[model samples]
Target: MRVQFSIALAHLLRRRRSTLVSLLGISLGVAFFLAVSALMRGSERDFLKRLVDNSPHITVLDQYRSARVQPAELRWPDAAVAISNVKPPVETRGIRSHRSKLESIEGWPGLRVAPVLRGSAVLTFAGQQQGVSLSGIVPARMKDVSTIDEQMVAGTLDDLAAAPNGLVIGQGLAEKFQLGLDSTVSMVTASGGARVMKVVGIFRTGNAAYDEGETFTLLKRAQVILARPNRVNRFIIQLADPQQARTVAAGIEQAIGYKSVSWIEASEDLLSLLLVRNIIMYSVVTAILVVAAFGIYNTISTIVVDKRRDIAILKAMGFSATDIRHIFLYQGAVIGLLGSCAGLMLGYGMMHVLASVELKPPGVSDVVHLPVWWGAEQYLLAIAFAMAACLCAAYLPANKAGKLQPVDTLRGAI
Candidate 1:
């Protein structure tokens, strides 16, 4: 093995230029692979962070996956009654016995729960009318499952809890309606309920649509204004570990007989798009390594042709076919190991350059730097892939060199 290594080292050094070119090709290919992967994965993590922070991990709505069965259908499991003239019963909206359900859900571990009565209403300030979504929230529970408390501009959720008739509106709505803290505004609901409520808090989310059309109030106040007594229409849930959302949502839906949607379910389209993007990204980057492998193949093949006389002499000196193959394989391994180390250093430098670049997103005011994931797996992946490609590239040439005939070569020389 020492003799083979010494021979391999001598062969590589004899054709230093070709070996240098092969090393450069592999190193550059690996460097770019690392840079692109870091940026793509980093951006994905950033987007997910914002989504998990802003949206509920799971939402339990006052609805079922399918239609509800009649009481008679429940009573008679196998009875087939052909009656077509009966009119369907008109059911009231909102979840019944919401308090008991809330208590039951609160017993679950690793989750935060809050009940909300959401409705649509008309807002009139100084005789100008605008429509908005009104949400009734329990201040204590709302803070646990929502980041709205962090977006407050003038007042807090506690202010709404303190003042029963107080309403929290968006900053854009406040500006458009010329309303501010302590200003009186009239809220009108389709259920023939109307009240003049005070604007106790204002929030700015940087999203024009959300800021201009959403308002919040106390849970009891919403129940009265929406004309639904002792009921809630939605449960906002945030999990301690967001990865368990799908499982938790499924179990909750099965237990409660309501439609529970997890964040993964809600963002299926976006997630699919991200998946497609990753596939395309990997394909493009791996092509670089594949092209670099061709250089390795060419260098080894050229070395075999140039070293034929040396090979014959070694074969006459009692070197086996497998020993000859190992020599060439070791040459490829040396290039791969050296290239991987150089490539990693270059990739780290490139990542630092990318991370230093700052950009301001369209909706927000603050500037954030480019995201660059520094996961160790990417480094391992680059080296493993590069080494594998190089070895595969070297295999054919190594096998051919191993089968050389010393007698034929010596006869040709005579």
Candidate 2:
């Protein structure tokens, strides 16, 4: 068996170019597939981590039917009444709150609740007007939800100067208005066109959507401008442990007597996008691998016919058909093994090259770094698939050699 294997190996080496090409095709496909899969997973994980780290774990909103509300019109539920409503709430609804009820959630177990006043409005300065969504936050409360104050690119939210009338703008918004720190702009309320605000500081949130359209003002000032005087939209909450988010969220809903939602629950659209991307990616890679497998089949089939005469000679020398088949299969295995190894190395090298290149959209951050995930599992999977394809590729050719008639083969008849 060992001698037969050596003879088979010699044949493959003599036709090294064809074997190499076949191996190269399969190896390249595996490498590309692995690289793409790693990149997609890495990007998703990074984005999720950043989002969770920088944003509140939970948020409490009034679950209102309309945009604005007045405390006089709505009675604030007390703590006892709020807690008694303990139960799971519906999705897509914000948690309900009044100033007293919202403020009451501050000391809840494993939770930090912060009242927020939010609304959409238009900013007008130097005859340049842009529409933006304004969030009224207590700087102290902002700390509980995010470390965004530290991410400020050009100005500080301190321009609110601890004053009720102070305001901050996102970096993208700042560029649009050509505004800087201490640069003031008038914010016109979209609600009944009732108010205006002065932009005191500009802040960059590092999120394109938020940075371009988001602005912040002190909670008290926001109330005054929007004419709500003493009410807020919702209480943004941060949990002590992220793993307990659902539990904490349920508690908030019951404690606040209103519907509540966690980030994972609210981010269904983003989740859908990720799922679609994964499906598309896997489907494309699978197709490429299938095509590469066919190449293996073609190469193996051609080599089988070329070696039929040799097979007949071996059979006449007393080699069994099974032994003949094993020789050709071994040749295919060698090709598969070498091809897969080379592909993995080259693929990883390409990924390293990609890592050094900075990628970003125009007028966006200077660089967007992507992460790469490589492991033994990926390599194993690639090699396993390649070998399986190679084995299948060799079967037909080997069978043909095994069934060859020695008499006709020796007479130079195919």
| Top-scoring candidate (lDDT) | 1
User: What C-alpha lDDT values do all the predictions have?
Assistant: 0.92, 0.74
lDDT of 2 by residue, 1-414 (tens): 798779878887777787777877888887887787778777877777776787678776666323333343357634244333334444322233375676577667777777788888888888998888888788876866777778777656666755455668887888888887666677778455444455566666677778888888887777766666667777778777876777888877777656677777777688789899988987786676667777767776777778778778888999888888888888778777887788788878877876676789788746876776666666677677777777787777878778888879999876
Tens-place lDDT per residue, model 1, 1-414, is: 999989998989999999999999999989999999999989998888888888999999998888767777778857888434567668658877888888888889999999999999999988899999999999999999999999999999999978979999999999999999999999999988899999999998877889999999998999899998877899999999998999999999888888999999999998999999989988888899989989999999999998888888899999999999999999999999999999999999999999999998787778989989999999998998899989988888999999998888767752
Which candidate leads in TM-score? 1
Q: After superposition, how far is residue 260 of candidate 1 from its true place, in Å?
A: 1.2
Judged by whole-model lDDT over C-alpha atoms, candidate 2 comes out at 0.74
Off by over 4 Å in 1: 71-88, 361-364
TM-score of each: 0.92, 0.70
